[model samples]
Target: MSYSDTNDPAFESMGNAAHYTNIASTLFFAYAVVSFVKDDANDPLFDKSWKQDGFCVTHKEIPFWNSHDACLYFDMMAALLLGALYWKQRNALGMERVNEIFGPSILGILAHGIGHGAVAHRMREMGLPTLAEEDDLDKTTIDENINERIMEINMMDDILGVGEVSERGRNVFVMVCFWVGLMKAALPNLRMAPFAAMVLAAMAGQQFVDRQFAFTYVQTILLVAFSVNQLARKKEEKDFVYATHPMVVGVPVTFIGWIESTQCSAFVKDSFYGHLIYDGFIPVAMLVWYVVCYLQIKESRDNSFESIAKTADRKGKVKVS
Candidate 1:
């Protein structure tokens, strides 16, 4: 927070770059970890399972920072940093305005971090075929693996297990936060009406659907609306970067995320590297939008003070006196 508050503009950029590099290092480390484990499944934890069940059914996760189970952990850190950034700005921007604009995203990131990291991670303990071998499996074997993969979706629909119920409920809460932010950030228009309604419908029926789909499309929808809003604002402001910079980083990657989820979904589900690139842009997207909102509020405050002049200029305009 103080980093951004300082007069040096490079401070915040440097901090962000450092955090990005740290995460990138973890990802490369994970790839090497995966290679080592598979090359010698003799690691005690996997030795028994690997021998008895073959590599397909043996769990490949490293407890601390595995590919799939660690996103929630990173999400927690991101939420904390994001919260700190907003905390310093809230008072200057007005608490209510900040809450309306930013509070949901901060809470949503934190909430999902806990939900996915703890709850969903536990649900994913069962091993599926590794990325290297998924292509070689026969129909029946592949069918079985597919069922195993859908266990999360099926569990969400069960309504009997208390854990699944709680997890789904938590996801729904995150869904609401996203919807609230979408409403606040995007200017309403007839053009966006149908898309908004469809998202609401999907969200309302999340128990029957894969929660990830809702998240992907919610982002796609929000980004489009956000871009349009920025375009409209650019007309009034005559500042291209102010209106378009957020879109520069967010839109194409999000569209790639959308495509990856729908077309190459199996790859994303099967590979750690795939998930890192496909699903990882999420936090990046959230931060871009948060920055956009911050700039908007600051712009408003700066513009508000310029309309009235000081007494020196008011000397000729003191008709009121």
Candidate 2:
């Protein structure tokens, strides 16, 4: 089953995508689980994300554990999977793909986890509201301008008011990840697509760091289109699952990501429970992707087929006799 002599150019690409899908799904599922389980009542004041006066803390204040902590742990899981995935593929598919396929996305997500950790630490050190309402803040304890501080989290656009440098740095890095990914893709390097997708995801995302309503739909639709294209292919490779399964995870990830934006009346979109459900879905979607990826890689190793019939299609891959 080793693909050492396979003629398909997509061997490495498919292998790498499966790996990414695994991490992404697990990371996403963690986000969802944490959101559901994090109980303000169970938390001591020190561990909660709100201040004494009811203002929202900018940091993920839990000492040993928090959402960022969950993400880092997931990143560790990703590292392990990456190591295993890399080892298998390099031996079977060839070592030449090691850096070219796996390096950037893995590194990007790791950096993203580090950035989140930094933001959490730095913001906790500052000890002020990154998100707050005027009523939540006490009038007398601090010297910062109240007008500059108060921002309603309920509104989408008001996130602009958060002026923390660490937060901004994280966002800027996310954008940079996407930009670099685009540059790679511009050269027709499809290998980097997952990295760019991670950029938009806030690193192997079950959650978009900055969520937008219509934007979620676009992501969902595009990924679905990708799945459809793979499914419609006239020639199904031995690695057909490799081509389609990763994209299949996209449907639920986008749907879960879209739930918050739905504003459905029955869903209580304005409630804390709603927030928990939305955040919770992030990890669920991620976990789904992980499962698919795991299956894909396992299948690839077991099903490496030789003598692929190179046929022409509308996309313009040249036909071979």
Candidate 3:
């Protein structure tokens, strides 16, 4: 039996409009980050910022006013908006479709975390004080000017750090919802809620405690489980299979990033090639993944709900006849 076209027109129109809008938004977000990497044209914007003496984006003079800091702020908001947009369309979309929009955004968030960690280390190497050190200042002995400067740096660092962590926490929530939505869209009968909740809790705990290794471990386990779950199905589950790609690819990159952070990997840490690979190349790989996922989703949309309804109707008619 041919699939009914009664609602296909409406659904197709909505999907196509949203699909283009999402692609445009994602490209704009990527361009923003690339533009920042290309030039620090906006550095002049924060010359009068109160905390200009600090070495890191979080500690830079002028709260919320530095070029690098501003990029982070913009990236965070862009990603948050994308995630929220996907959430709003959850019922109308499929698992793979949601991942097509979200997978890259979440990976970018992880990259943002790595970016901050890199900045934190560089600041430490430059002998910059952390927010923790500002408390050691005695209110009475220091000159008013010096005390005020110290307070400013400390406060700015605290605010930026909290913002970073909070952003990651929100990403965790969005990821959990994405997984749940994926399950509902693909494997509707499976009991995946508990597993999804557990995954979220694990990620949130790791984020709160600032445990990157632990978080990575949890992510790895979940990915493997996801892969296994899909393989177990007698019927092929292509979407679930697609879900494993990021997980499998991310583990090695993440481990390398971690290793590069340590003294043991100083050869890679010091070399230009090392910097290129760790800082420049790896993140670009993430951008590539997002672009690929977007294209796949776009190609798959035409055959989605319409195909499902038609297939179901064909079987129903066959049985009746």
**Top of the candidates by lDDT:** 1
Q: Cα RMSDs of all predictions?
A: 12.7, 13.3, 15.3
lDDT per residue for candidate 2 within 285-306, as digits (tens), equals 4344444545555555445442
What candidate 1 gets wrong by more than 4 Å, as runs, is 1-60, 94-99, 124-153, 157-159, 162-204, 210-253, 262-272, 292-300, 303-307, 310-312, 316-321
Q: Which prediction has the highest TM-score against the true structure?
A: 1
The clash count of every prediction, one per candidate, is 0, 11, 5
**lDDT of prediction 1:** 0.45
The candidate with the higher TM-score, 1 or 3, is 1
| Model 3 per-residue lDDT tens digits across residues 65-177 | 33334444444554565556546644543344335435544445444433444333323333433344557755333234333443333322322343467754654444454
lDDT, ranked from best to worst: 1, 3, 2
Model 1, span 258-318: residue lDDT tens: 3443333345435544344443566676577666656755655455555444644687568
Q: Which stretches of candidate 2 lie over 4 Å from their true place?
A: 1-59, 93-108, 111-115, 118-122, 129-188, 191-239, 246-248, 259-321
How well does each candidate superpose onto the true structure, as a TM-score? 0.47, 0.39, 0.34
